[model samples]
Every structure is written in C-alpha cells, then in structure tokens.
Target: MTNATRISATLPPDLAAFLDEYQETHHLSSRSAALAEAVRALRDQNLQEAYQELGEAQRSGQETYPDDNLDGLENE
Candidate 1:
C-alpha cells in the first residue's frame, strides 16, 4: 500500500454539506478517501492532456523518429 498523509482544510457550508451527503450516499469511509479519489482523477486528466499534446506535436513534425530499423512489410 502507498503511504498516506493527513491534511485539514475548511470548506463553505454548502460544500461541506455536499461532501457529507456524498459520503453517506456512497458509503465512503471518510473525507480523506473521497478527496484522495478526487485527486487521483485530476492526475489522470493531467496525464491525458500531456499525451494529447505529445500527439499533436508529433503530427505537426515538431517531433521526429529515426528510421534505424528498415523492416520490410507487404501492404495489402
């Protein structure tokens, strides 16, 4: 298991209430679990954006690949 860290923050009444309701509805153990999941989701989004940018750069010829292995294949 990965190491865990504890953090504390204050939220507005409405946000606090929403989180409470979400925990009850989803049966989450604690706020930390919910927040951790949220952070993981955000990280995934960032990684996806980075991958998209790399693809765009490659398409625009801003990136290059050397053809070191000249393998022959028949195109049907």
Candidate 2:
C-alpha cells in the first residue's frame, strides 16, 4: 500500500456539500480519502500535460528523443 500524508484546506460551502454527498454516495470512509484521490487526479493531469508538451517539442525538432521506440511508448 502507498504511504499517505495529511493536509488541510478550506472549501466553499457548495464544494463542501458536494464532497459530503460524494462520500456518502460512494461509501468512502473520510474527507481525507476523497481529497487524496482528488489530488492524485490533478497530479496525473499535470504529468500528462508535461508529457504531451515534450512530445510536441520532439515532433517539431525542438527536442531530441534518445530512442525512436520511445515515441511509440508515449501513445501506449
């Protein structure tokens, strides 16, 4: 299992209500779990964007990749 970290933040009333509903409907244990999942999702999105930018740079000849096969791996 992955290790976890604790964090705290303030949420607007509407957002808090939505989170509460989401937890109850999904049978999630706590607000921390929901927030952790949200953070992971956001981090993944950022990493994907960086990967896409690198791909674009390589395609435009602004950056060079070490191996041609690595280009195919990006799509997979």
Candidate 3:
C-alpha cells in the first residue's frame, strides 16, 4: 500500500514538460515522486536559511523568538 495522497495541479507548459523529462531521465517511478523530491530540497534550503538567521540573531544579541523550555522538553 502507498501512503501518498493524490491531488491535481495545473502547471505551465514548459515546467510540465521539464518535469516529465526529468522523471524519465532520472528513472523515477512517477512524476509525483519527482515533485516530492523537489519540494523536500526546497524545504531543506529554507530551513537552513532560517537556522542561519537564528544563529546571527543570537550572536548580535538581538531578541528573536521566545526561548522557552525547549531543552527541557527534549528529554521528556
């Protein structure tokens, strides 16, 4: 059984063709898998940028988000 949910999307002509070619060239099982990989890559990039911003804020002594009891929660 698969854990994927299906949805319909309308892509531009050029992007749709590119996705099809990429799927074929990389031997992915389906276009859905290709799209999932692309989204995961984008998410990783955004998360890295966010971590960098947080680190800079800490270094510059700027008040960012609340530093609640997060370390305590990790042991629970």
Per-prediction TM-score to the true structure, in the order listed: 0.68, 0.71, 0.74
Q: Write the per-residue lDDT of candidate 1 for residues 1-76, one digit (tens) a residue.
A: 1676777879899987887887778888988777666666787787677678767888998854346622222221
Clashes in model 2: which pairs? none
Top candidate by lDDT: 3
Q: Where is the poorest 10-residue window by lDDT in model 1?
A: 67-76
For candidate 3, give the lDDT.
Answer: 0.79
- Which scores higher on lDDT, 1 or 3? 3
lDDT of 2 by residue, 8-70 (tens): 789999999988887888888888777767876787787778789888998898855445434
Candidate 1 regions exceeding 4 Å error are 64-76
**Candidate closest to the true structure, highest TM-score:** 3
Residue 66 accuracy (lDDT) in model 3: 67
* Residue 10 C-alpha lDDT in model 1: 95
Q: How should the candidates be ordered by TM-score, best one leading?
A: 3, 2, 1
Candidate 1 TM-score, C-alpha based: 0.68
In candidate 3, clashing pairs total 0
